[model samples]
Target: MSFQEISPADTAESLRNGNAVLIDVREPHEYGAERIHGALLYPMSTFDPRALPIDSSRDVILHCGSAKRSGMALMRCAEAGVPINKHLAGGIMLWKREGLPTIKVDPATGRVFDPQQG
Candidate 1:
């Protein structure tokens, strides 16, 4: 079975509840530049569920620069037995657009982005 898709807020909430997995499909370089708090590195182009931490019973959420790639990855992972409960609607760009928390990765020093509070 395939996984369910939801908004970034729901996904983030799932993560906060400690019951979901967040997989960023972007490459290491891109991921290093910016990523969600608990998201892991699993580029869809090169990831094989049989190799990574994928388990059919667990919740898995895939993401990319845009929802396009993540959607594709979600389908593929679902076909590969990634569990029907897993959630994946899109990428982090939209999540940021929603005003959710995000970390910007710096290429030079590899620092995370944090706009200080006023």
Candidate 2:
């Protein structure tokens, strides 16, 4: 089943307020290249329910490069009794498309950079 979506504005607000947990379901390599400032890494192939710091009662947002993987993860998380809270409506790409903040992690020296600059 498709999961509920939270708007970019709402997501940004929740994130700024430290009330939202952003779960990124992208590959480790891909994530190392670039991602949001603070997102939880949870590879779809190896999602451990117990590893999550989220409680089903709280706000937990999931995402992928686009929206496909996150959608799948959301269904699986719900099926596995992880949580039923809010998730990214259209993934990070959408969030970026909406001009949201995204951080690029340097693979060479492991440094983080702001995407807005370059």
Candidate 3:
């Protein structure tokens, strides 16, 4: 794999320290439902490596419901000659499993809540 995988703990730390930014590769509905607090949405259905907001200041990490889509996104980046090579290993499922925080929106109330609280 040309890409490197980052664990939820490490990803969280990186984000907390402002050393990295997350890119969500899931669809719009999935992103609207729940996601890492600061993750920027860029659905795989319309993902374009050329249009990614990569910069030299911070590393960009990609993620989806699972690592599959993010892995595919990495491949796309590689094919397009984009150098982004990190993803949240095992995705949000693992992130939640690791007890990390996520922003969840209630479909009925449109209210956001902490999954750990509900």
Candidate 4:
């Protein structure tokens, strides 16, 4: 099944308005290195569409390093009868390119900092 793509800017707007839940489908290590500030980790390696916290209150948007994994997850959701069908286009790469806020761990300090600020 086809899925709808939400741009990083628009995704940020929805998140600011509390209208969307961002789910990162990348692996744990990948997420630990850097990620969207409020994105929740739900690695596609162990993804279970049925387990997703889906509700009418918020739109669940999936994303990954480049959108490949999220698209795959969306297809999995479709097969499992889950209604989540939106994702962040171009994934975190594009989000970063667009100068959005991201929480990144500084290897030397192991502290989280906004990459956009650097």
Clashes of each: 2, 0, 0, 0
Residue-by-residue lDDT tens digits, candidate 3, 1-118: 4789999999999998999999999999999999898899999999999988888999999999889999999999999999999999999999999999999999999998975457
Instruction: Write one digit per residue (lDDT tens) for candidate 4, span 1-118.
Output: 6799999999999999999999999999999999998899999889999999897999999999899999999999999999999999999999989988888888788988875557
lDDT of 2 by residue, 1-118 (tens): 4577888789888888888888888999877787887887988889765577775445888888777887777777778886644578778888889988888877778787886567
Instruction: List ranges where model 1 is wrong by over 4 Å.
Output: 1-3, 55-58, 84-87, 108-110, 114-118
Error of 2 at 42 (Å): 0.9
Better of 3 and 4 by lDDT: 3
Q: Which stretches of candidate 3 lie above 4 Å from their native place?
A: 114-118
TM, every model: 0.78, 0.82, 0.94, 0.93
Residues 11-101 of candidate 1: C-alpha lDDT, one tens digit per residue: 8888888777788878888887777888888886697765556555556677787777777766776677754344456568788888887
Candidate 2 Cα outliers beyond 4 Å, as residue runs: 106-111, 115-118
**Highest lDDT against the true fold, candidate:** 3
Candidate 1 backbone collisions, by pair:
33-105, 104-113
